[model samples]
Target: MEKTVSAHHACVRTAFENTVPAAPPTSDDIWQTPPPAPAAGMLDVCGRERRLVTRTRERHTAVRQLPDSGSTLENVCRTLQLDRSTVRRFARATSIDELLVKATNRSTILGRYKPHLHQRWNEGCHTSAQLHQEIVALGFTGSLQTVRRYLRPFKAATVAPPARRPAPRPRRIVRWIMTDPGNLTADDAADLKEVRTSCPELDAVTHHVRDFAAMMLDLRGDQLPAWMERVLADDLPSLHSLINGLSRDIDAVTAGLSTPWSSGQVEGQVTRTKLLKRQGFGRANLDFLRKRVLLTP
Candidate 1:
């Protein structure tokens, strides 16, 4: 049975990520409407980002062509076999580039060691081995080859760009939103607060998630209807998918949430049985597999 309380955090995260601007926006240019593409060859957008842009463009065009009488979020989700968040994102984006910024400009893990790499590079420490070892000692954990690859782009340059706020991945942002506020570090809390302030949609979703978390933690399945109603009142297409699924089997979902009974033990037993069966397949017979499954801890 589906849990009484579930969230479409991944869907919401993807939708939110599409809204991140490539460059820092001024107060007057929130997200820049259509952020200009980076200068060609200045930054390499990996193949995946290009493919994502193409796919999003297709969805965006499809949603735009939907007839007026059949263009509700639910209808779009059903017709396209996509989640609500995806439909909403595609329908609302001004351009495909809006969905491409994060993939192109997101912070890389090697970013932290840039200043060190640059200072050492300029000081004539051209030896990859020495440079790799030096940065490793300074808390760099990347492979030596990564250092070699990045150096190619800065081979002739005597400088690197100034550091900027590291863009946490969509999944990381979702985790920050889903986790209990009390469990987050001060830095994480502060960053999440800033993110919420910048994007009111995310802020609204966070509120819904916190409320859902509390209902689940307290085993308060009785409150699900109220929670769902509140969520529906907002433009939260991401969560609507979860609500739709739960509404189909509300009793079972409610019982699953309000009680501790679950299929966990049964699934564990099945998994162990498979492991024992595999272990005995070539080395022994069915009897051995059965004995192991039955007697082994």
Candidate 2:
């Protein structure tokens, strides 16, 4: 019975196999081809418009290309109907910090001149003429005035240029010691008072300087005219001696003071000097430091 059942199953399978036929290869089977066009109405996943990309050759054929060098300032101005100066200015703006760096660099050239000037001056070669000659040799065609100004500090050193190693510059030491104002406090006023009490002449000088300071400080707005009158009326001789003939420049001083401005600028500068001194950092010489602070800004 088992053999008869197996024979029957085999006969049925053979009959089913003979009814189905093998399929021929389609065109896609031979070519492995892509579709001719996208499927109808397919939307991009990102919801943005789908842009078709092209090969380099296709892109070149689609648009006109301009020559790279054709965008010069003159050409750009003509193309955009704009002024050439406007474009030039925009292109040439190098930044304030860049300008500052360049100026500082140029100023540092004078630093080189410092050592040479000192060396020459030490050997009794110190003269405006000699220094100017050396500067001229070094390509400084500016003027004798420039040379004079540059060499002035060396000549003013408290000690002559040393024949041995450079003197531990007292001026530089003073500057380094004095750059900060930490000690110039109420204590300074007390000390100054004590010194004034000990020396009669010193006391007189101190009082004069203080009065001058008070006069300058008091000159503000409507109070300025009254203040100036008081100062100018007091001991004209003493005023002359304190500020030289600058006391006679009364009108200019009054004008400067009357309009909310005073030698606050000058006093502020002196304060900066004392601060710099306390900080123990200035040029190697006090005179040099003085000139630097005055001339730098």
Residue-level lDDT tens digits of model 1 in 1-297: 011112222333333344532343333442334322222111322212345446656777788778355677888788989888877876765455445434344445566555566667767888788888877775567899998887765656555433233444455667788889999988678767766766576787889889888888889989999999998898666677888999999999888778867799999989888887777667888777777777897
Candidate 2 TM-score versus the reference: 0.22
- The parts of candidate 2 lying over 4 Å away from their true place are 1-183, 220-239, 261-297
Model 1 global lDDT (CA atoms, 0 to 1): 0.63
- RMSD versus native structure for model 1: 11.4
Worst 10 residues of 1 by lDDT: 1-10
Q: How far does residue 206 in candidate 1 sit from its true spot (Å)?
A: 1.3
lDDT of each: 0.63, 0.41
What's each prediction's TM-score? Answer: 0.55, 0.22
Model 1, position 18: C-alpha lDDT score: 42
Cα error of candidate 1 at position 249, Å: 1.0
Give lDDT: candidate 2, residue 124: 79
Best model number under TM-score: 1
